[model samples]
Target: MVASTGHEPCELGPIDYLVIELPQGTTTLTEQMTDQIIRSVSDRTLRILELLIVERDGAGDLTVTEFEELTDRGLRGLDASLVEILAGEDVHNLASAIAPGRCAVVIVWEYLTATSFTAAVRASGATLVAQGRIPAQAIAATLRGDDEDA
Candidate 1:
């Protein structure tokens, strides 16, 4: 059996999550990164589906803080709430991965769907064969002319 959304399917781009650790003594997100997200969303390059900050104490206990709570708790300049992004279990899993005495900023975003391009591909009967990502380290090494054979 397959599940559906009770509506027609829509073209969607890739979704990815990044976990950025705030080192000890750092409590808030940097303005630079916030501006980047704002710029991307404004330009229609990507959409932030969910954003969260999870803190872990010295005893490895997780403190779950909702994105909306941050707005109330003084996470300045951020005024959006994505309350229904991920399931509770998913949130827990992300929090569990955080190291003690640190907090993680998790951003789940999707590249804006290329609606016309996808439609054109479908009309041309071109089916997706495979999809994968090359690690950034490999790309960096290739760009730097570093030998990857060893």
Candidate 2:
């Protein structure tokens, strides 16, 4: 089930009876549906922004020779300009209007941090598992029920 942020109330009764409390006024069924659609699209755009940042930072274009040396990888055919363009399209002007503080820009920033960590690990030739158990364990620890041990 999708988790709502509780900014809107949900009803379990007849669809026609559903009402949404908005800043303007109580919203009818059509307005509520429209709000839901808009929120969904915004969330999707943020996810895309996160992905683009990951791709841009992971492709080894933002850094220079030090970055290449640190990663122990050569960027022989990598196109820095193309990475910049891809990253640019990930964010839209609407992001600032809809989610100024926690918007697509924040997502991109977080992704860049994560990408840097991954690159450092890769450069060290450390036998750290990129995915699978470690991340799963961390998430499980974070999301464990109140009754479960940490």
Candidate 3:
């Protein structure tokens, strides 16, 4: 038997990507962050669909590594299955933006908490048209009345 959502089941939530840059002199993905990622996936708060690490050499060459390659470099607590969702184009595009002599860890994940709500809205014939994120710096400036200084 197969489970269904009355309508076709979708992954049903916002899929978002994050690029975390490590300035020169930083070495590897931290073990603490790896453990947090493991905890989130185990408890279903988030589903990591793709993980890519891009490194830019001082000469501006880029190297892209997928999940397994990252594991070899000490990114623990990740399952090999997540590599299946890697979007080559996505990784390449993000890699192109990295500054020389820096490294960036890119994770594409689904917000599991919003999944059921998304499904219900879809079933009701509603659709999400737009969404945006406000930078924390902007929020802080507003609260500090620093806008006047700008």
Candidate 4:
């Protein structure tokens, strides 16, 4: 069951979420990154289901804002307006992982490339039971046999 929502079993594609943190006072959302995202959306490679931002102040106070809110706060360079699809619980959950004095961009996206496979699975009455992500650092450490550090 989806958190904070009623028991409505909706058919969803291979959706995934990511929380990307930027260092304090860092502005890494360059024009190139924006262009790449626009291209992907235009090509139907993926769809931005949700977009949220979390900012942690020096005193460790957290502030969660939606896409439009962020744009209103002098972040008006993006060419797209993402939907506010995340629930309150989702914002809190993603915010909990971010560090103090840092900023994080939480995005929930659907992988269009997996549409056919997901459709097939749904047709067979096989629902996705579970899913998890292993961070890139962990994968690299395991591949290099750096178990101690990992």
Candidate of highest lDDT: 3
Q: Which whole-number lDDT from 0 to 100 does residue 103 have in model 3?
A: 91
TM-score, predicted candidate 3 vs. hidden true structure: 0.78
Positional deviation of residue 122's Cα in model 1 after best superposition, in angstroms: 4.2
Which one wins by TM-score: 2 or 4? Answer: 4
Per-residue lDDT tens digits for candidate 1, residues 1-150, read 111357866565666777788878765567777778777877778777788777888998777666677653333333452335688788778777788899888888767755456656666888766667787888888888887721
TM-score of each: 0.75, 0.20, 0.78, 0.74
lDDT of 4 by residue, 1-150 (tens): 222236755445567888889757863444565576667777888778776678878787878766666543233433263556688887887787888888887888877777777767877888778877778899899999999857
Candidate 1 residue pairs that clash? none
Error of 1 at 39 (Å): 0.9
Q: Per-model C-alpha lDDT, please? A: 0.70, 0.27, 0.73, 0.70
lDDT of 2 at 89: 32
Candidate 4: lDDT over CA atoms?
0.70
**Higher-TM-score candidate among 2 and 3?**
3
Where does candidate 3 stray beyond 4 Å?
A: 1-8, 72-77, 80-86, 148-150
List model 2 lDDT by residue over 34-108, tens digit each. 454335334532111121111113222221111122221222222221122223332332122322112111121
Clashes of 2: 0
Candidate 3 C-alpha lDDT tens digits along 1-150: 112558864544677778888767764567776777878888888888788788889998778876777644444555753645656676777777778899988888877898888777767888777777777778888889899642
Q: State, as a TM-score between 0 and 1, how close model 2 is to the true structure.
A: 0.20
lDDT of 2 at 30: 36
Off by over 4 Å in 1: 1-5, 72-83, 113-115, 122-126, 148-150
